[model samples]
Target: MGHQQTVSTTFTSAVGERIGASLALVDAELARRYPGDPGTRQPVHTVYVPADAFDAATVRSWGEGALAALDRHAPDAASFAAVLGIPDRLAGPVYDRVRAKLRREPVEDLRIDFEDGYGLRPDAEEDAAAARAAQLVARACAEGTAPPWTGIRMKCMEAAVRDRGVRTLDVFLTGLLEAGGLPEGLVLTLPKVSYPEQVAAMVHLAEEFEKARGLDGGRIRFEVQIETTQSILGADGRATVARLIEAGQGRVTSLHYGTFDYSAACGVSAAHQSADHPAADHAKAVMQVAAAGTGVRLCDGSTNVLPVGPRERVHAAWRLHHGLVRRALARAYYQGWDMHPGQLPTRYAAVYAFYREGLEEAAGRLAAYAGGGGGAVLDEPATARALSGYLLRGLDCGALDAEEVAALTGLDRAALDRLAGRTAPQD
Candidate 1:
């Protein structure tokens, strides 16, 4: 055999940078666009009420009221299970936890809707409604009954309705600021975005408001609704979600999927429009991948089937809503739109059950992964992040206590906190 020289591999930082430089740039961009960990108290559901019907005092009691409905309709875990079609063994814990959570923090996020929920009124009446919403928000703030997350969703900014949408937003913000400073955790939601220009325009409006109102430059953060096909697909034929988030210029904090509108845009029949429909699922999956690891929050669409009819019919509606919520939970989309107060108990029931079922297993796997111990379960960095987030969310929602988490994972409170990246005490 002829002698052949062996090739040697050499290590060099310059070579490494040259080979992976685009990745560095990509990482930097991702970091810049990423929103960071969501708040510990992120609401499992955002309840929407027509802006005109918003009442500060009554709004505070909506959660309890939802609980009351549950009490009347399905007082025990067995009855709740019967309504949701889940085994009592599965429903029991969720039922108990949901009741407690409703008592503790019935509503986490609320949107006083000025769009679909509040149909277009005369210009003057719309402005008055805006003022009323601001007044209610101010009262909620002062009385300490406001949810940790609350916002207003104005009309869509399409050509025909653009002016009305802008006016509503301007009027609402002006009233909110003049009444009392902006409520804590306030965000604005812009619905039915069809183009990046709409997002840019909204961001510009927010900037102007911040400057004119003497608010912080980025204080007027908003969420874009991915309701239209155009919002999901960019002009260049790529996912528009990241572009939408990018266009917000850090003023965008979340993206909400509007189930009915999105399904309708896909040409699905009105009767078939639903949260778990294939079209809706595809949209949300695209959103998940596009916004993954980016700080921008993702919310699933609403189940419009309200549990409010005759007894049997109401129970049927509740079952439908519960299935939708459970489907969303299985897909790891925690936040969703709850159109009616009657949906709250089922929402929490589904969410709590999802977490409770996975809690012990997730905690063990996370501990083993974090500790680098040999275990049957393996975890990627993303999985680890998700695990930490899962437990922290449970803690925030009152579903899991620090002691319970520590005990389950064999990690102390300090370890759990560090995993959750909690540098400061959670509010």
Candidate 2:
């Protein structure tokens, strides 16, 4: 772990640090796009947000009032307590309900969002909520209050320009620091990352925020919402994401496929924005290419149509958490989301099963290789060759325990020792 940490710190530059982001070496950009190919069978870490929750009237009201309190907070005992209590008082029920739902969700599939998961709108009332949510988000990141991962759709730079006086994006970040001293490593996702410049600008802002807030700037992660034609097929589209990271100092952590916006960007029928659709898959591949090309995590957007009726909902839950989730995991997603509690179990199972399956496959290969006493020729097309990379990918998921890895391969720590000397590292 220590060695690995050192390697990451070396490779990943912190925000605002004078680190150089070099992508000029890749030569050409993505040669091929991911046909929204979910990938080689692992659950993508799904950050589920409650878009509908933000629509509720009460949430909107809470946003306005939260900021009013922030504006007048002072250096008095009463004021300080009032400030401390604000999050608990205003965000308590909202957080509790979300937390409870997460806990009870049929699966341990992780869900991340704030103020109900969607980005804050620019309306006056919602500004305060956005600020509060930002603070809450920071606290969660700093404190590990929930799962290890979470994502937020912060205000787009364009949106900020349109909103006039109050810069909601900055407020959101401020709230985060005030809430809990940057307790968490938050993944701030930007919507509609159309041009490389947009991506670059956002990265710069993120880096600035980190420096200003006194947090490890590079530690502040990011996910780009790929939803524009310019990002996919434009003349520079192939290299758009590449260029963005190069210019922005390489802070991108993941590239997410935004289906709805992609459909529109493609000038296709919006009604047919299903993941299974050929066009949607094409766009996902574009995103995958960008991600794969740049060595970042790739995630697909949520399936919009959800099951609602009792039986349908149950089945819907299964289809998503199991069918889709399993399929996605098998395609090699780090994790994926169950939008509702009902879908959680299947999502969890699929994610777990992915790593478990891989571990077992790897163990068998390594054990057999050990038995061969280094004389075994690992047929590139067969068990040993396949298992090498296979096992490593399983480890990447960070889902399995050492014992679990051992169980899958029937190899104890001692056996692994022998194999490591005999085998080469898998890709």
Candidate 3:
């Protein structure tokens, strides 16, 4: 019989206790600042319409316009695929889905813009528009015709327009409250944020609004538009975007990249200013890093290249927009801005094709990991989380069917949610 060998322990439980106590503040900070994903359906794109131009028929008009563009430009699947260079395998399905999506839900997120899109307007005119916007949005919500997410982009917190911005927001909110309560999908955007103090002010403004309205403290969430270079890199040389997130006080739902403004701030020439410019990429890279694990999403800027004019010109523009969108998806920036109704077709096409092309492989990898079976690709827990998230997003955007995902992965929504770390941990 062999004698059992015993291993001696070097450290006592007190050592671990000491280490844990020393890092208590760090633990708390991590929990507070990096709370992880919120497990909600993030819209795939934000369509901006000038507040003065938006009305009850705006959404339906956009859909009709996009569909009309499709009918006139690429009436058939083959032609549409050829225009956008979609592979033969995915051309038909992607085309069909794009048309259906345009008809069913063309605009995922609609923003009634009072900022750049609206430009500078007279005070009375702007106030009336703001109040009218609220009434229209409330009516849409009540009629069940509102998009899944709908909101307004008020003027920035700049000193010149600060008071106007505040009054507009107050008027908008008050009008909503008077018309009815705030809609469930309501969002507010603060653009041209150049300092952390501005974000803090926004938080205070939201708090004051909530208190006055007798609403919950954290009820109002908004997106911070990273337009100026100062918003990305501060005078102190730190990552200003990260500081801005901290200043948001848990009310920042997303950080929206401003393509033209950011590029112009970087001094890119007008001819070369585009979403895929190196400067834009660098800014977005910093944004992605800072927003990681913060439960805050990142939105890529839009391309100004609208698909219109002659057939060849429209095709060229569609290809450009499609390529940029695909590139954005590959970089994990799932949401972007659509400036025109004509861009909607290419947007949905790119999104659907991207998810569909990778669906089989992603499903297989996830299924293997979930089933605890060895596969060609040995994925870690982190990769498993990403795989599940990709599938969930695909499902959310109507790119992938839940039934098909279940059939392939043998894991339903609940199982996928658990794997994606979207469910709260059980003690």
Q: Looking at candidate 3, what is the lDDT of residue 35?
A: 89
Sort by lDDT, top down from the best: 3, 1, 2
lDDT of 2 by residue, 1-427 (tens): 4564433354434643432335333323432222222233233445455433432222223323322222233223234223223223323332233223334322222333433254455466556656655655554446444344444565454554424212556666677667755534455666666677777777667788878777775766567767776666767426465554455455776776666777866777867765556786776665655565354677766665553445445444445435555555555444443454334333433444555545654666576675664433463334453454455445444445566677666765434533332233221
> How far does residue 18 in candidate 1 sit from its true spot (Å)?
6.5
Q: Which residue runs of candidate 3 sit more than 4 Å off their true CA positions?
A: 1-6, 424-427
Q: Rate the local accuracy (lDDT) of all candidates.
A: 0.82, 0.50, 0.94
Candidate 2 TM-score to native = 0.64
Residue 178 displacement (Å), model 1: 1.9
Q: Which ten residues in a row have the lowest lDDT in candidate 1?
A: 33-42
Q: Against the hidden true structure, what lDDT does model 2 obtain?
A: 0.50
Clashing pairs in 3: none
TM-score of each: 0.91, 0.64, 0.97
Candidate 1 per-residue C-alpha lDDT over 1-427 given as tens digits, one digit per residue, 9 for 90 to 100: 7999898888878888787875888878766866466444566878888887888655547777888888889998898887777666677777888888777778888899999889978999999988888888887888787888878999988888889989989988888788878876897899999888889999889888888878888888899999999887866788788778778887777789999889998999989999888888889998888777566778888977888877797798888888888888778787899887788888887777777777888899888988898588778877777788888877777667788788878886557667765454566
State which candidate has the highest lDDT: 3
lDDT of model number 3: 0.94
